[model samples]
Target chain A: MSEKILIKGNEAIAEAAIAAGCRHFFGYPITPQSELAAYLARRMPKVGGVYLQAESEVAAINMVYGAAAAGVRCMTSSSSPGISLKSEGLSYLAGCDLPAVLINVQRGGPGLGGIQPSQADYFQATRGGGHGDYHIIVLAPGGVQEMYSYTRDAFDLADKHRMTVMVLTDGILGQMMEATATENGEQTADNRQEKPWAVGGVRGERARNIVNSLYLKPSELEATNLSRYEKYKQVEETEQKYDSYLLDDAEIVVAAYGASSRIAKNAIDEARSKGVKAGLLRPITLWPFPKKAFAAAAKKARAFVSVEMSMGQMIEDIELSIRCSRPVTLCNRVGGMVPDPAMICEAILNANKEATA
Target chain B: METRILIAGFGGQGILFMGKYLAYIGMSQDRQVSWLPSYGPEMRGGTAQCGVILSDTAIGSPLVEEPDILAAMNLPSFHAFEKSVKPGGTLYYDSAFVAAPGTRSDITYIAVSATQTAESNNLKGLANMVMAGALLKSLPGADGGVIETAMKKTVPERKREMFDANMKAVTLGRAL
Candidate 1:
């Protein structure tokens, strides 16, 4: 086993991507996530990888699209507003059925919001940020360790699914430092899979592969969308990931993800000490949404509380996950503010009260 | 045992570095530790602060809202965070900067002349280390050897020459 080292979350993500055999990185500098690009800039060249600081988020994502079409592991990262700038490239990548990793170390948003930690971009990440009948695999990392592990695994998930896989994290997780064990030394590229459909010269072995998103015919477009939806359906059935704590007999279930889930775990412990039967269901995969876990919790839970660093954006998904069988409450902080454990404990107490009432 | 520490000072005072050192100490002891800094515009010129949590079990909520230990390196930081320490908690401040100690009677306040000590020892820009030494003296399971080890690991290789001066500053604070 590798020895644990003290590292920041953003650096962890960058190193993990390198360990996962990603050789191409294109990104624009943005607050709360710039460290990721900076780390890559310093380290990527050492590994014979390309780390290009694009002119803008739009250009960075398109660069990712280009590299991904060549069957190379590639990625781009940005904050909330920068992510909005890359939405167009996201759609193009999805429409063309390319594999890529996108990292959104989120800050508060609508426009140019504050650069503090926030999960406000939940909707944008899980709802197919760009316009289309499509979905991207979104992994919400709760801490620095997940920031590393999820980023390493995301490359494989993207390649296997032939779609974009997003590591949707917040500023707190991005900036925080913790002790974690990562794969040491330079990584070998022995694990990369061959992509038969990539846009490279066939050398007369087969027809040339064309990577394009434009379907001139309506029927072809519909068929393409249908096939993509079928892939998404398979992902939904098997890719849901979550973590549960003290949940078997919980009456009040707290549903949270990313940074909010860490705070919620503390609140659950506080509530438990105060005689409130609270539990936590932390979603690791935001796109798949962990509906099965929530549905199981709803069987024994009387109420659900969504703790978020947004204005209750994930609450809608929780409601739909359980089919509204249980009343779900929103315990949130927004505009770059994070909810403390005391606030979440109070919310849990209130939910417990309503559950028993 | 779980201890939440909040360290605050002006930007470039090594406030975040002090917190990270404490986290490293925790890690050396095989404890779960987390260090989170206050980033963005406020860190440019305004007061800079960071939260460090060291616990025996899994740590939740890396944000230290009500710190069990508060280290204020400047007057503004002391004034800003004096009231946020939990009752019966500990507060350490640089007496050379903060003219007066906190008015709170519930918590113990340790006034260390961290800045003066650092300046006198020719270890300028290391008052944060002095304060860290003072904090280590109070923290359970953190001894001089542990701190020395942590310091050796925390300080970058390029700055190895300053190890002696940093140790001198830490020893002075521990003496206080």
Candidate 2:
């Protein structure tokens, strides 16, 4: 246990990456998430790690792929437009079965959008941003502490699943500051699993390991994709992480993630005070989607409200998760705008009215 | 108990720093605190603001929409956030810089010439601290001694020489 320090969420993620033994960081500076790369640039060298500001987002993610293939924990971070450029590298990393961490401190976007907090990158992140039959483990951190702990655990998750682990956050969570204890007693490099398949020098000990994503043969590619899907299936079953608040007997369930979840929680509290049975189900892992929790809550929930910073992107997931058993409504603000608690509370109240009507 | 504070001013007016200092003081007292800045392409002289929340329970949203305490350091900030203060909340403004009168009677309006006090006390560029001192005095359960301890941690190590001047500015504001 270490003393709590008031730190920015971006800096907390950077510090946690170092604590998790991530030695390589390759990133291009982008708004909202620039502090993360800047922090690493200052601290990486002091901790005997490598921090390289690549010429472009493309180069940065490729650099991450290079480091991860060499059996080192490495990462890259960017905003919405920057993440689009790195999508190619993300697919390559997935195809190669490389372990790495990536961060998307998202801003509004289709291209070159405004630099404010947004959850518009939900589809780009959760549905495999690039071309391939693949999925990255997406961890959406709601607060500064989760920003720290999740980044640390992201390294382990990447290694365990042999895939990219993304800490999908928004500009608000990245820029906000909160009291967090950076040092947890359990984080050390010694706890990391050995990467025997890493393409480091074999020293003439057994066969050399090869790292490549190329499989031209149709049969081989199909087999590889099948095996990867099996891994993803297992992850969906075992790694679904979420936080439930007053959900046991609630008739209105609000499904949210990342920064929007914080707003949803506040709205739920207000709704409860108004005699509405509104609860919050915040998904910590966006890719896994916490389907079980949603399905269970749907049994008692009459309606589900998805509060998001995007134009109802996560609403599809809520509908799919519950198998459309309950009516799902969308309450959203987009283009760098965030919804206040009142707006979400109004939506919850509307859902309550609709359910009874 | 919870206090949602919104501090707004020009970028170079130490708006973000004042919010951070308050957040540090809250943390020192073992209160749950969160500070969020309104970040964008705005540079120095452009509008810069931050929200600080100090609470006893878990904080849901860090953004302060309807602030319980609104501290406006400049005219633009005062005009922008004056109406957003909760009813029965407190609005602290630097009357020297913001030259605005309160229109609402529901909220308490306290005017302090923090800018003039800082300039006279040779604490230029530290009017934010002065306003913060006034806020500390008004905040419930905030220990007066905690400000100095938090200042020790809040002020960067490279700028240790400015500690006394900052304290002096805060004291002048408190006395006023």
lDDT of 2 by residue, A120-215 (tens): 999999998999899999999989999999999999999999999999999999999999988742355535678998997789987999999899
The positional error of residue A309 in candidate 2, measured at the CA in angstroms, is 1.0
Docking class for model 2 is high
C-alpha lDDT score of every prediction, in listed order: 0.91, 0.90
Tell me the TM-score of each prediction against the true structure: 0.98, 0.97
After superposition, the stretches of candidate 1 with alpha carbons farther than 4 Å from their true spots are A202-206
lDDT of 2 at A176: 96
The residue pairs found clashing in candidate 1 are: none
For residues A1-357, could you state the per-residue lDDT of candidate 1 as single tens digits? 278888899999999999899989997898999999999999999988999989989999999999999999999999999999999999999999999999999998778989998899999999989988889999998888889999999999999999999999989999999998898527545367789999876899999999999999999999999999999999999999999889888999999998888889989999999999999999999998999999999999999999998887899999999999999999998999889999999999999888788
Measured by TM-score, the strongest candidate is 1
